[model samples]
Target: MGNKEQTFQKIIEIAYVMFAENGFEKTSLAMIATEVGISKPAIYYYFQSKDQLIAYIFDELYKEIQQDIAVDYKELTSANFKEKLLELGYKSIEAQGKDPYFNKIFNQYVLLAARDESYKSQLVELETSFLTSFVEVLQWGVRLGVLDDTPHIEAKAQMLALVYDNIGNFMLTGNQLNYRAIWKEAVHSVIQGGKDDK
Candidate 1:
C-alpha cells in the first residue's frame, strides 16, 4: 500500500498492542505514535482523536472476529441445530482464543460504552447485528423441526451467545475447567426443549 495507508495500518497495529498491554485508559496517542515511529500529528492525520482510534481498532477487530465465526446463511436451513450450534460454540471459543488480547480491549470498550453515549450506540449496533444472526440460526432450527419452536427465540439466542461468551472469557483468563463438557451442556439446554411437544 501507499505511505498513508501503511501509516494508518501501523497505527492500528501498535495501538492494539498498547491497548492490550496498558488498556485504553492508560494508552496514549503519543505512546502509539512513538511506537509507530510517527509524530502525534501523523497519528491525527489518520484519526481525529484517541476515542476515534480506539473505536476504529475495535471496529476492525470485531469485524475480524465476525469473519472468523461467520456462518453461511444458506447453511442455516439445515435441520441439524445440535451439531451446527455446537460447532458455533466451538468456533466462538476459537475466535476469542485466536487473539488473547482482544478481550482486554473488549472489556475496555464495555466500560467506556457504558459512560459514553456515542460509544454505547456503536456497541449496541454491533451486538444487535451479532444477535440477529444468532436468532436467525435458532429460528431456522425451529423451522427444520430439529429444535423446539419457542416464541422467544431471540431471548434463547441471546442466552446461547452469552454462554459462549462467558466460556470464551474464562478461556481468556486461563481458567482451568471442562470447557467442552460445559459448552455442550449449555448448548443442549438452550436448544433441547417445541410448539408441538407432547
Candidate 2:
C-alpha cells in the first residue's frame, strides 16, 4: 500500500524471523532494527517497544488464521465433513511448518494473554470467534452426512490445540513424530465416537 504500511510489514517480517531464531527472551529490539535495516528510532516510531511489537505480531497472525478459515469455509461448504476436517488439519500443520515465527508468537504471547486480566477478555473473544467458525464447519459436515452427529461440535478447537502443542513440543526439542497420522487418528476417533456404530 503506502510507505507507512510497507514499513510496518517490514517490521513484522523482521520480527518474525528474529522471534523464530532467537525466541522471546533472547530476541532484542536492536537485533530487529539491524535485520530490518532501519535505525533504532525508526523502529520505535512504528513500535514503541518490543512487547508491543510482539503483541501486534500475534494479533495479526491470530486474525489471519480466522480469515483463512472463513475463506475456506465459503469455498468448501459443499465438501464432506471428512474432507473439511482433513483440510483444516492439513492447513494447521502446514502453517506451523511454513510460518514458524507465527507459531512461536502464538504459543508464547497469544497464550499468555489469557493469563493477564487486561488481555484475557480480548483473548477469550478471539478464541470464541475462532471456535464458532470451526463449529459451523462441523455442523455443515453433519448436515452433509459425512460426519456423524455428535455432541460438543467444538472438537475442532481441541484438535487444533493438540496439533499446536505437538508442534511446539517438537520445535523446542527437535523431536519428530508422524503428526499427520496422529491427527488422522484423533479425527477418526472423534468422528467415530460421535457416530452410530451401525
Q: Which candidate ranks first by TM-score, i.e. highest?
A: 1
Can you give the TM-score per candidate against the true fold? 0.82, 0.73
Candidate 2 has an lDDT of: 0.68
lDDT at 106 for candidate 2? 59
Best by lDDT: 1
How much lDDT does each candidate structure score? 0.77, 0.68
Give lDDT tens digits, candidate 1, residues 1-198.
Answer: 999889888888888888987888888899999999988887888889998888788788778767755677566554455776787777666666677787877888888888999889988887777777778777877777777786777898888777776886788689988776787887777766522111
Candidate 1: minimum summed lDDT over ten consecutive residues — where? Answer: 189-198
Clashing pairs in 2: none
lDDT of 2 by residue, 22-53 (tens): 67778888888888888888899999998898
Residue 77, model 2: lDDT of 47
Residue 18 shift from truth in candidate 2, angstroms: 2.0
